[model samples]
Target: MITYDPHKWLDHFFDIRGSLVKEISGRVLICVFWSAGVVYFDKNYHDVNISSLLHTLVGLALSMLLVFRTNASYDRYWEGRKLWGGIVNETRNLVRQATVHLSGERDLVVHLAQLNVDFAAACMYHLRGAKIAGMLESQHPPLTIATQMTFALQEARRRGAITDIILASMDQNVQLLIDYLGGCERIRKTPLPFAYVVHLRRALVVYCFSLPFALVDTYGWATVLDTLVISYVFFGIEEIGVEIEGPFGLDENDLPLEDICTTIRHNLFALVELEHSEPDKMPEGL
Candidate 1:
């Protein structure tokens, strides 16, 4: 996602990158020009004035629909973020547990760490409907890595490297990872209702196009400015919803999956190194 200081008011107005202005600019311009034509025609040739009261009623309904659409999309986005946060925490907890329980078996600890990283990376790719370069062609890469993690824990238990209790604890973390993965998949695969989206967009178009007729009588030439501003607000809100609906994509507003995966890898490797060097030197808030 595009990072910025929200307090910087001037920068936001000047910044065009990753803004919804680009997406709605064309529509706003069309609305402005259409309003101008309507006003000119009404003044010179024929009157096309309509009741502004009708627009008032339609605008209220349109605002409610836009609010609902935006809220639903943001709910999916926030849920996805929360699920990934769970994954991050669980991965750390699992690795920290393994570091303590299997301290003597450095290779096994490293392997477990790498597996966790792989699982996260696989999950990122899987949600995006893509494949990592080295990952084997599998129906579900995250599940494959999850299975490997389970086997590793099982083998540790079988060989008496870790007790049954330790194995169970680590296995629980693995299950949580799968659960988070499922949550993410649900968000990515299940979109908003088709009829709802269709009706919302249709309402927006009808309202914005018909707004010029309502404003031309009172605002005259200024109807163009009013229509442009109103269209921009409505279109921008809808576009923002679409941008964040699927939070796994590469859009500037989408979740930073790539950076998140990289962070998990780095933290795991750092934890491994810390354990190897000084077991007592664990970080404060890992």
Candidate 2:
């Protein structure tokens, strides 16, 4: 994942609002062309009417609403990103602490490392809308979700070959995992208010539909081009906001959680191995 400092440049490039000017400019050109057509058909239509006023007002309102939507969506998107950043830090901290405190202790170190991997995978699955298999039990169970989950994790700690200090670190790691999970749940459960979404969508549709009528009298044939460009710009931004709000999944643009998890695994393993083994060159695969 992106481990670099969260820069506004990233926001400027990725943020939806940044393209509004371009969208508006292109549509204005089309509107002008269409207005010329209408003038050619009937010069009297060149005079602005109430419909023209309404069109201007609607365009202005749509622009403002698009800005507001982008702001709100980015807020949610950034918050989710920040939360994941915390998870990465905490995960690394847990492993580092375990390695330091449990020096010369291999058994517990292995167990803790495995737990770290499992936790990251589980969280990924949960966020991607997958049912956390092995998390629930009501079907029929000698060991229910409650008994199995708590017991398995605790038993891993109790029986693992780590030193006392390492065990303590593992406990802290578990708590951190719980907190991260709760944060993820909060993002998942709480969405943009339904009323707000409904209002914004209705406004967008009305704006797009009314645009043609308002511009047609003045721009004629150019109205079609103007309408398509303006409509796409507004819709494009709304689509991005919708995508970012979830911030999880295998979408090409979604946060790269899998890559982050793999990097953590590689780093932790490399650190542990370096501490014990001498560096050696390896031959190409057999």
Candidate 3:
């Protein structure tokens, strides 16, 4: 989503706009102040005696858990991408097949092609949690439209407009479209489980808050700086996982759902446009 020129290391470091800075800065500040308190408490009333070994063990355990959390989140993201990728490829195949087999039924083919495009947009809108008018399929507008398109194909087949082999091919693509919709819905509906999220958050918060106490005796006042950096890393990783888990929302890391549908719409129409735009090449004899 965020395109960049190849490997400008300095620019990446200084960049603030798209950085996780906004998300992590507040927590980083809290860590700094919390660390400062730990230092003051140690300087005034002796040290808290929190063991370095104890903190190291807890941090190690939490880090492993975070790794699992982030990995699961990224798995969902990639799954959503693959499902939508299937939508893109299968839609094009469907349109191309229609153009080949239903060439004589120009109007019908164009209408069906447009429906396919509509199905794509509706599918994305469904994923993004947007409400559709008339409440078709109760916010599952994509599925509703998909069914309509399939029925239309059935009618065409019954009318003897398309051959049996061609109908079978088109039906396969339609089934794929339905499967994609189901896959996206599965991701959207089932997020990281509640108990898992709760435990992870609680452990991370406890670990990060206790870190300064553990380090203050060793590093003294420098604990503030260290705490900020460490907090940024821990919180940033989790925040990134949260943002990308859905892969359908407005987050920059989320898939570009609208753009994908827009390109497909353009392509489907363009495929049809090519036929009308230029006259067929005259035969050599003609």
Off by over 4 Å in 3: 133-139, 277-286
| lDDT (tens digit, per residue) of candidate 2 on 15-53 | 544344544555445544554554454445444323778
- Report the lDDT tens digits of candidate 1 across residue range 210-266: 998999888989998899889999999999999999999998899999899999999
**Candidate 1 Cα misplacement greater than 4 A, ranges:** 279-286
- What would the per-residue lDDT of candidate 3 be over residues 100-190, giving only the tens digit for each residue? 7777778867987898898998887788878766665464678777777787677778878887777887989989999998999999999
Better of 1 and 3 by lDDT: 1
For residue 239, model 3's alpha carbon misses the true position, in angstroms, by 0.8
Question: What TM-score, over all chains together, does every model reach?
Answer: 0.96, 0.71, 0.92
How do the candidates rank by TM-score, highest first? 1, 3, 2
Candidate 2 segments exceeding 4 Å error: 1-50, 132-170, 278-286
* Candidate 2 structure, TM-score to reference: 0.71
Residue-level error in angstroms, candidate 1, position 92: 0.4
The model with the greater TM-score, 2 or 3, is 3
lDDT of 2 at 129: 66
Better of 1 and 2 by lDDT: 1
